[model samples]
Target: MKNNLLLGITGSIAASKTEKLYNSLKDQYNIKFVSTSEGLKYLDDNFKINNNIISSWDNETGSPHIELSRWADKFVIYPATANFISKLNNGISDDILSATALMYKDSIYIAPAMHEEMYINEVTQENILELSKKHIFCGPKYGKLDIGDEGLGRLLEPDELINIIEKTKEKIIVTSGPTFENIDLVRGITNSSSGKQGRAIAYELLSKGYDVIYIHSDLINPVPHARNITYSSSDDLYQSILKNIKDVKKIYMTSAVSDFIPEKFNKKMSRESGELFLKLSPNIDIIKTIKSQYKDIKVIGFSAQLDDNLNFEKINTKNCDYLVINNLKDNYFGSDNNKIFIIDRDKLIYESSVENKNIIAQHIVKNTTS
Candidate 1:
């Protein structure tokens, strides 16, 4: 049976974000909703009582708060209001949500949402500090608020909150974007990778609780939850990965590293000069290098083969646990949707139809993670 998640919705304008949150997590957990009276007002009639919603303290047999607390594996209060925060801090159990929160012994994840003044108020700050020592507090992020004023006290996005609630200590290293191999200060060779797929995978991993160390070229999009390290050249990215791989358990090699680099350095190249001659040398394989040293760590490699004829044998030589293959003919570079084939040493494991990168990311993580 799936674990039960008791989602507590409080009175805040950001309460509306819970619908998205529910939709995202419903498949992974058995979710039950419990909303405050004010929270109930914001939700439509679709939030039916007894079936999924638990609004009141009234129960036929015994205390609903106690029973619900016992049933829940984890409790999360999204858009936890200033009023509720104060009530929780003061140990006031006047309502069903507060009463249930008081009895819940496991970690209670809270995402605060309120006006800027109310969030920064001394009382709320103190209450937050008190709660932080025992429970997890996601965010009252800085952004536009419900009252047309923009500042701190905006509820965190649903994905951010989910990442916090589901977070684990395990480390994952994700490398993205194209690595440049400079022939001169002005000229270089690089691949066409835009790093969209890698960024999406990093976000998906973060949402599922992995602590991600993201290494990428400066051009790639950055995920909010990752510890991002920027690199320009293939050598720079290789060194960065080695520096941060001490405790990492998994490495996603999504960066399109240059296969060859200039054998000799040139200060500058003139276009007016006669045809330039240069010697090129093959670059070190980053994934193979890491896997050779850290055999226990799982390595997932990405191959962008221009030809439809994929050499699975060459991929197997890298010693990666999984290889994600994409053909250049499919126009994967910089595109939001992708068609991918995931294979192991023996055979292909999963083949995805052209779909959004986020969906592809979800499948990759689901297949890779135990």
Candidate 2:
């Protein structure tokens, strides 16, 4: 049987593209469309999909919202407007699309289109972050918007949407945040990693239908829809990996693991004893150990350093299939934006300009995985 697909169209200029999207999916899917009243204005007159389209509550009988929400195997909101997204998040079921979305419990794929400024507004972003927990999003790709203005609010192309909605799914592990080595009960050493990058990776993976196990430190929040595991020290992280390694296909080792662990004292050190000497020992080499023990599992290592050059030797030493590098010289620690380089053991494969961590993640995952 063909997959059931419900495409919700809202009031955006990109709704004109809905006919193309419908025609693209008709062969592979049992296609149905539900458009907000305003959405009907922008749709092309050439649309045969009007026969299958539901425009208002009165047009359909006996709770169409509930029926549509339950019927679709894949539910998408294409050309989702900022207003519609806000309404969906706040439970304002004032229209057909909003009502159906509110009734839909499964992950809804949202493709947004608006001005770049509105797309990037703090309110919209907050709504997106919150809703992403139980939904998927393809793009507002960077391109021409309405009125010839160009930025990142363009709707994704038909093929891009098809690829995302039908992409092969996999199980993978993603580690985030900084590992802390406790010196005593009161003091510890850790890096400045805020876990934003890893969160972005997990979010992207979730959107692509990857089953993600997210290992993160308590200092950062967890990615929704991922199986979140919290770790403190490097040893704790390694143990978490060991416990969850069964049937895992890949590991994105993005956490900033502490290189050295301080010797722990059973008793808390008083301020008077601060002058005493201490010993530091090298922490566990997690990636190397995992690669050695489970040779089939692909481990993607991450390195953050002040040097601009890619270190092929470091990647070789760790046995990572790909090493993602971020230059700390740019002073981007804990920031939501990043520039990155992806290197194999032999040479650099990809480099990204400074952008949001989510965008950076898409480049990294696409290159390394492909």
Candidate 3:
């Protein structure tokens, strides 16, 4: 079925590209162009808007904005100005895009484009938070501004927008981090892990253009830009993963799952003083479950052992397609330096210590693709 989309244009240098994008998208789907006052300034007087177009003019006979919002399966705004984004966040209804966006009941997305400073401002961040809270999708991968300033504030390209709209139907899922098995509210059985390896791998997958669903347990640094489901205990993590596994293509069990959990949880620990007796039980084996049931999905697991000699074949038998064996002698858990021996089915790839996760992530992606 041909999709109906409302493309909201806001003021930015990149707003000029919207007409070309509209033309391109028109070939595959229905296009309705709505522009902010600042955006219309750059456009022609009689801007060749066809019957498919929806102008924000309240004086127009039909309620074009409302009708267009209803008609659209998805609404997206490209070259979203900082001022326009702020208005949308605050429900100001000062412009057509913001007003129609407030009315739109369907999936909505925005592509923000502005100067580096404007994009990084607290107000802009708050606007982004507002949009996120509404469950509105955004971003094609974080990039710098069009003005060549470095940072995350770039409007997504036409191809990227189209790709996300299309591929969202069948997206790849990735999970990352360590799983703790709780004893009580205060105590838990956890692994010697910081979730660095898994986070790095997830980012690697994302960079290679894969949609990621990261179940984070122990995050140590700048969090990966993926759909995150946080859990503190192994049981919680286990259930969450099991629930989402049906849609997953590949299950990367990079989380250092706790093997033991307290069988007897003490709810009234403070009330009872003295020796406490706690029984322990094994947590769910995530990799094994995926391997047994979800045979169609590729399973990648990680093992951070204390072994000094890099014997990858022995480590590969741990039942993961790719097993990242990082020697504890180098402090692989929480430390920045990582020396890993990647064990694949037929080959072993060795990596030296590196500081940047991006570099390490690229290596992982290369191996996965190869």
Instruction: Give me the candidate number with maximum TM-score.
Output: 2
Ranking by lDDT: 2, 1, 3
Model 2 residue runs over 4 Å out of place are 1-3, 12-14, 48-52, 70-73, 81-92, 102-107, 110-156, 203-209, 221-228, 266-269, 272-274, 335-341, 351-362
Q: Give the count of colliding residue pairs in each prediction.
A: 0, 0, 1
C-alpha-based local distance difference test score of model 1: 0.82
- lDDT, model 1, position 291: 86
**C-alpha positional error of residue 206 in candidate 1 after TM-score superposition, expressed in Å:** 0.7
- Residue 177's C-alpha lDDT in candidate 3? 61
Off by over 4 Å in 1: 1-167, 264-266, 308-310
Each model's lDDT: 0.82, 0.84, 0.66
Q: Give one digit per residue, the lDDT tens place, for model 1 in 269-290.
A: 7777879788988888888888
Candidate 3 pairs with clashing backbones: 180-234
User: Which digits, one per residue and each the tens of the lDDT, describe model 2 over residues 236-273?
Assistant: 99999999999899999999999898899777889786
Clashes of 2: 0
Model 3, range 1-370, lDDT digits (tens) per residue? 7888788887787777777677678877887777787787655455544433444576467676677778888788876788877887777876667788888875576766777578657777666755765644445233455657544455667766666566653344555566666567666666667776666666555544466777777543323245667776777777878877776877667677777878746563664577877787765676776667767776766667787555555444545567666677766677755766667756666565654444555566576554
Which has the greatest lDDT?
A: 2
